[model samples]
Target: MELLRNARDAGARNIYVASVLRRRRYRTLTVLDDGQGVDERYATLIFEPGVTTRHLNPTIEAVDPNSPPHGAGLSLYHIRNLAVRSSLLSAASPTSITVTFDTRVLPERSLQSTTRPSRSNLRATVENFARTSRTSAFYYAQPAKILASLIKNHIIHNDESAVELVELAEALGLRISTRTAQKIKNGEIPAIERIDGSGDGGRRRVMTERGGEVDGSTALLDLGDEQMSRIAVILREAAHASYVEVHDLRQSSRPGEITLTARVREPEDEYE
Candidate 1:
């Protein structure tokens, strides 16, 4: 129920829910949507209680009449606690999400998976995704190099200092605490490190523990359609390229390697 709500809130116009029988004992349930899927970065964070991307007073109602209309983020968290095995998959461009559940595994592995989800790690992931997806507008060949150049050319000068990043965040009207800024500068937050540019040229620098490397897994970014559009405009104008697109490089040699590619946006390209 909560998963459905999340998809609806993410501006999904079409949603599909499926269930399959596994060996007549285990049941597999799946929900697929064309909405603003969970960001590759926020996949696990969404399983944490009290974490929500929806507005404070979202118009969407709860799937259950007894549940609160707010705090849709808690839905999946609670469900994960009760369910057996679950996964969240999302992609950019089309902003598709697929959530699956394998209830058969819960009874046996519940004890082994009792550790609470990491809030700090989730916060860092979200912060990075927000900053980068909101800022970077284009992807190009040699994305990492181009991004580094863009930051040096426009966002930052040369020195990569914590204080400078904090100041930069403030200048851009983003709320970053001293501790958070320091963590980002030090690369403690492996998802995103810094965001640069203002107006139409906003860009973000993402850092990851595993750089440019993916083992056939999807990493979602927690960005909205409006945010991507603005960034595309900025990158398009700045790169002087006819095309601009954003993609998650799960298989990169560098950690947090977001590529800027040249693919002109069309009506069907809208993520929402």
Candidate 2:
């Protein structure tokens, strides 16, 4: 949350959070933002206690009394100390901060057991952040697949053209190009499948239809069920549709094709 708050404070419009596993034993978390680049001189200093470039805004303070004041810079200090290693690289635009941890390290047991961090925990954190954040945020897993995206609510709820919907789908790593999304919108291509409900929050799955073409014909989303369901809600609202359908293309007899569909329904037919 500190990393995200810092990005927002820096006037960033988009923020990306990514988690990567290396050598099967180490994990790295990266938060990158295309905000005003940090000066090379202060890149390392910003992590020090009581060192900060943020200025408190009266408007923001009025909205959230708990907003940090200027020079209250212990957030990064604590973050760095908790991680095995952390670094800030801001020589150019899109400042990037990375924190790495040794996943093999066992917790020191005390009177009570403690749960180690997992992907689900990360998802929950991001979801909570999305609910309140005003800027666009994206979460990605290793190999550059976007697992989830949080778009501004106004665009999702008010946009009439559905342009933002296509952007949201693309940000979620749906593998749909602008042209393809346009085709889907025009009915030239089949409707895209969407999750029916808040899915069973379980392990990530990469379901692909057998022999599916490697081109744009297939979209392999590696996301938990809850994230998928949240995305479906956004897509449905953006498209002004009642509900979107989720087709299990893996069960189809066709050798190499998959498709998604969405349809309009009566207001009374809406699902809870």
Candidate 3:
């Protein structure tokens, strides 16, 4: 959270956060931002306690009298101490910070313990931060998971141009060529019902297994047989989906088309 706040304070317009597992042993968290970056000379010094370049803005302080008078500068210091390994890279513009935790060195408490954070946990963290963030924030996982996050968060809607979608995908480390992005935008490759209310062609509605209806907000993704379990994990974790239903729309009209839908848990629903 402090890392995100630091980026925001640096005047970042776009921030990307990624949680990755390396060799099934190290859990890594990377935060990248397109903001005024730190100078190479001060990169190491910025992580020291009481070291900061920020000053309390008078406008913000006037708005909130309870605001701190100065930056404490302990955020990066604390973050560095908590992680097994951490590094910072900066240039004139974009800056990146990575923190890795070694699973082997961490204490085990449960039989179901895992080395890395679950998809749901990562999604929830990003969603909570995005609720009040002034800048755009993206969370990266697998390619399919990233696409799902983009659509679910309204970062990439059906109306978005193929170029825009491709650019966003590239930022998340998913290299989508212009042709594939165009196909996705046109509902051609990995074809699914269009979400935009264009005409009768886009009139289809998604239904959950419990008979609930999903409106135009439903996210669509194309997946193969082997990718079903991966997508299921994302739906279950990120959306707290009760159940997922798959419909094989493959026919003469749309060859190899498959649609996946899930029931997102409402706020009123009891937690399991």
Candidate 4:
């Protein structure tokens, strides 16, 4: 998001972001944007777990026009849990929409075993066009598409020092002020959560509804902006770096039991 250039775009002209700290001393992040808003029909489903614009685009005619579930019910439900009270501000024009994520409760574990290997959608799109066409393909394309998403969303870079993210942002052509950089970094949730050694003698955090801790693949770290920037750098480093990603040291523990697993799979196979 070349801020100076993109600020004039109709889709994201009115975007604003902030962190709301609650009485319980928890954090709820809010993003108000003038992008194409979520339709009222999809409002209830936007935060439902696993719901995505990609899936919703294909099934508009299959379901009733007037219905409870617009699409995937789980992602929004998962969003509800992560952010506590979640909703689309959709305040003014249909294009102006907002999403709020609460940092009080825990994140979903259904996809805890899941790993999101990042890719450059912009490049992928162009590459798809190049396929079966010509050797002189989408060339010189670098980090522009992802850069726009990062800039437009005004990402929350996790727990890193302000100077760190700023330098990277400059590399990606982000013209954000230092004040905005601090704001983005401040929204990061802690990466290394303390295990409860007291209960059963440990202060353990559990994601399972049964109160049994699922120690493997928990969010040991949040992908703050700087972290995401680091990821972009890694992806750009390798032309073969399709779906490349970056992460910090993440560990999960419990007083009595803990689990850890790391594996890789092909593009079609899901990661666990």
Candidate 5:
């Protein structure tokens, strides 16, 4: 039902649904569409709470004031919350959303045997599985979106060290390596990059560079300035009491000159 809503929201006139048992205990549910597909930038974020592209346009609120709040972007989020594993594959030519559900709790023989159960019994089992899958919700809820942008801005403007950024990330509950921080600083880890689909509307591909090897797809993180600032302040306060984002250290440095500043708030009032 939620997938249908997303397909309609994407302006897909004809959506195809396919289900198959890939392994003994795994089932894949794929939804194919021909519409304005999601960009690679928001591929992963579409499942995060309160993220949406549908809200960009003027919705039908003016036509019907009594309408419920639309474009919460919660459909995919909830779908992901329900599924054991989920994925979104989008292309300019053809868009698709695929989700996998684990049916391992029930033996494969029970569902796929020659002596199949009644339609009502099978439906009940499927519904029960859906209900119970919520126990395995995704839990990586650190403010990574904010932390990524904060690190990017600090690297560009404040000349913050990778070590410092990693420290701050860890302080704020995000665990990233020094190499990842360097990649982000060097623009190798872009916030977003376009994927080139094949001429025959084949699979979507994203190119990435790591250890001199061009790798497969990478998703982008979309973090707004306001969100970054708010989360930064919160994280800073939590990590170090009373210290804030002061720019006095950069006043005397030449443009692009790297310098590290260690600021401590003195109880006595004194200006640096």
Candidate 6:
């Protein structure tokens, strides 16, 4: 959510948060930023792991991995491929970063709604999705990079197991099905895990350690190639039947297409 906050901080003139591409109901979103560019020579320099220009500023000098520098320096430059944008090449004075994400690939987003949901009110709908934390820095700036990184990097504060896959997906503003839920469980998609350890020993586990993780047997796509191809085939058949199916498919799938799982520590959870 800090990414949302930072977006707001940059006083970003244009905020275009929308679905860029879609897969078998999955979406990959692209967030472009026109904030002041990095040093042309240092365009690629910012993304190197453990690299940050924030240290130059005394206020942000005490840089803990947790206490990230300005959101700019701390986002996922490490996995530029995941973002699939040229950090160096794209980051001219007006820089842009596009993040491609896997939907249903995470638990759900957390809910911290201050107000109750109202069906009669259109304002409620907008407000529900509206950015709540007004001052978190990236609120106005594009959050794709930071948010994708946050979920990918497991940098947020929370207990992974305490949160369910569907719940984490909600936190990220997406959804899934029982089959999808089972995949998250089966795949153990790194960021969040189920609190499934035996006896009382398990209850004491930290949130980060409790959630499931991706393993060798897990298919890269939660739905697997067969299901995805099957869905694609079904869609193709529907499309052959009617052009309306194309619109229906897109409209029904957009929100969930762009999903991100909660970020988890690699190889080990801090809780353990």
The candidate that achieves the highest TM-score relative to the unseen native structure: 3
Candidate 1 whole-model C-alpha lDDT, 0 to 1: 0.43
> On a 0 to 1 TM-score scale, where does candidate 5 land against the true structure?
0.36
Stretches > 4 Å off in candidate 6: 1-13, 57-74, 78-89, 107-272
Q: With candidate 6 superimposed using the best TM-score fit, by how many Å does residue 135's alpha carbon deviate from the native?
A: 8.5
lDDT of 5 by residue, 92-155 (tens): 3345676766766433334432222321233223233223232211111112332344343332
After superposing all C-alphas onto the true structure, candidate 1 shows an RMSD in angstroms of: 21.2
Candidate 5's C-alpha runs over 4 A off are 22-24, 58-65, 69-71, 104-272
lDDT of 2: 0.51
Q: For residues 1-272, write the lDDT of model 3, one tens digit per residue.
A: 67767776677766666566668776666666667777676787987898777654321333357887334778888877877877775443457776777767753233231322232354345545555553554444434344434454444465668888887655544445777777666654432222222332222455544565543222344455557677666655665444433333231211222344554445543444
lDDT of 2 by residue, 1-272 (tens): 67777776776666666666667656677776666767677776977887766544322533477874633778889877777887775433556777776767723222221222343355445445555664544444331232122222121222324466465443432334556445444544432221111332222333344532232212443444675577667666765653444333222222123344444444555645
Whole-model lDDT per candidate:
0.43, 0.51, 0.55, 0.37, 0.47, 0.36
Worst 10 residues of 4 by lDDT: 1-10
Q: Give the alpha carbon lDDT tens digit for every residue of 188-248 in model 4.
A: 3222221222222121335554664543312333345675566555544552355533334
**Evaluation by lDDT, superior candidate among 4 and 6:** 4
Q: Using Cα atoms with residue i matched to residue i, what is each candidate's TM-score against the true structure?
A: 0.33, 0.48, 0.50, 0.26, 0.36, 0.33
| Candidate 5 C-alpha error for residue 165, in Å | 45
Top candidate, metric lDDT = 3
Scanning candidate 5 in windows of ten residues, the lowest lDDT window is: 134-143
Weakest 10 consecutive residues of candidate 3 by summed lDDT: 248-257
Preferred candidate (TM-score higher): 2 or 3: 3
- Give the poorly placed runs of model 2, Cα more than 4 Å off: 56-63, 66-71, 104-119, 146-272
